[model samples]
Target: MVQEIDKLTDNVNDIKSLFRTLNETLESIEKRLSRLEKMDSIEHRVEVNQIDLSDIKESLQRIEETHSNEIQHINRRLDSHLVKIAKIEEEMIIIKSR
Candidate 1:
């Protein structure tokens, strides 16, 4: 009877050991799944940033075009002012001669 009790105890211990191992395996799997979920989130953010960068590039191009046109217009105005100054200088010189 004592030997039979010992055998039953051994069986119970074996079952407990198997349960612990299974629990550890399940925990490892959960950790791996968490890492995969985090990676997916990072990938989503990267994709969103790529789209935003493209939009920013387009906006910058438009700004450059607008500034270029403004600069051209200013240059033309400056040229006109310079011509007016030259005409006034010529008139002043003639008046001084008299």
Candidate 2:
């Protein structure tokens, strides 16, 4: 009977050891999964930032184009005014000579 009890005790100890090993393995797996989740989140944020930057760049280009077009229009108007002034100056000189 003592021998049987000894055998049972040994079997229980073995089972406990197995349980400990399984718990350790599960903990390790949990830690790895958490790290992977964090990495995925960081990657997603980076992608979003890149997209926002692209939109900003496009908007800036459009603004620059609008400003450039406005400057050209102003220059044309100035040129037209200059021509009219030159013609008036010529007419005044003729009248003065008369």
The count of residue-pair clashes in candidate 1 stands at 0
Q: Estimated TM-score per prediction?
A: 0.62, 0.80
Candidate 1's residue-wise lDDT over 1-98, tens digit each?
Answer: 99999999999999999999999999999999999999999999999999999999999999999999999999999999999999999999999999
Q: Report the C-alpha lDDT of model 2 over 1-98, residue by residue, as the tens digit.
A: 99999999999999999999999999999999999999999999999999999999999999999999999999999999999999999999999999
Name the lDDT of candidate 2.
Answer: 0.99
On a 0 to 100 scale, what is the lDDT of residue 44 in model 2?
96
lDDT (Cα, 0-100) at 42 in candidate 1 = 97
- Candidate 2's C-alpha runs over 4 A off are none
Q: Candidate 2, residue 46: CA error in Å? A: 1.2
In candidate 1, the residue pairs with backbone N, CA or C atoms under 3 Å apart (3 or more residues apart, or in different chains) clash, namely none
